[model samples]
Target: MHAIIQSLCTLWRPSWQGMVMGELKYRRGGGSGGPYKVAASGRRIVRVSASSEAGERMDLLLFPAAGFAGGARAGEAGAPWHRFSADEVRRYSASLGDHNEIHQSERPIVSGFQIAEAMGALEGDRDFRIRFHYPIRSDEMVSLRKEGKAIYGVTDVLCFIWEAL
Candidate 1:
């Protein structure tokens, strides 16, 4: 087996509780296939701990959550690591005129954009909503592993493709 398959099998143990399978019914574009069209969808999960950020809570961690038609990657996606500093948050708030005192305060906590959903700040704007996940703050760390000196975050990214007529 390939290295990727080996690693995945080692890491993920599929249970019989939840499994799905299907079959393709037919092919499109007639039998000759003038222009074959192929579609691909992918999802990736990344795990980052304070250890990866050099033992700093303020450090940032970046990953390629989405890909574009031109194969463009998310900002800082090439880097396996990033640092989330107060200075960066402050700068972003300043640039965007988000002068909320909570963002400017020197508190040990930052808000999660998901909280906005509970607070009714999120609307139909998905982009803005996701950006909230990045810039917003929380009163307490929402990361898992609340005990000891470690935290973990899990983010989901959705990407798609479209052809113009």
Candidate 2:
């Protein structure tokens, strides 16, 4: 089975409203390609997971920055991946109404992306969903042990939907 990878939650805040965006990257053995662009809406559900500490809920691992590092592995396609920093995680948590101490306290936090579904529907009447398969993340360092024909390939095109009233 192939593994699913997700990128960090990037936010663009120019004014009162904040926009959230993420990237998906991946590569198989013996390939020379590039990262592809992905479009997402409120209905999309991305599977995500990360390392957890004591008293932490396993569900928290479902966040975008919850899985393996996203980027180009050796002998694979695309560029390297950059892990998300605690500061970035904190910022996302604040913007998303997540005040977890694990993300707020002065401690080392894990970074990366995982697969997960959108927790809620879109806030407005506009709804959309996007699915992309490939190198699920972008970074400088990647695990060579996990790159193989059967281990690295698109397994499914996850579909997410949302309805606003």
Q: Global lDDT of each model?
A: 0.24, 0.27
Q: Would you give me the overall lDDT of model 2? A: 0.27
C-alpha TM-scores of all predictions: 0.22, 0.25
lDDT of 1: 0.24
Candidate 1 versus truth, CA RMSD in Å, comes to 21.5
Best by TM-score: 2
Question: By summed lDDT, which 10 consecutive residues of candidate 2 come out lowest?
Answer: 52-61
Residue 29's lDDT within candidate 2 is 24
Q: Write the per-residue lDDT of candidate 1 for residues 27-144, one digit (tens) a residue.
A: 1111322222222222232221111112111111222323111322222222122233566545544543433354465641132211322222212212111211222232322222
**Candidate 1, superposed: residue stretches over 4 Å from native:** 1-81, 108-152, 155-165
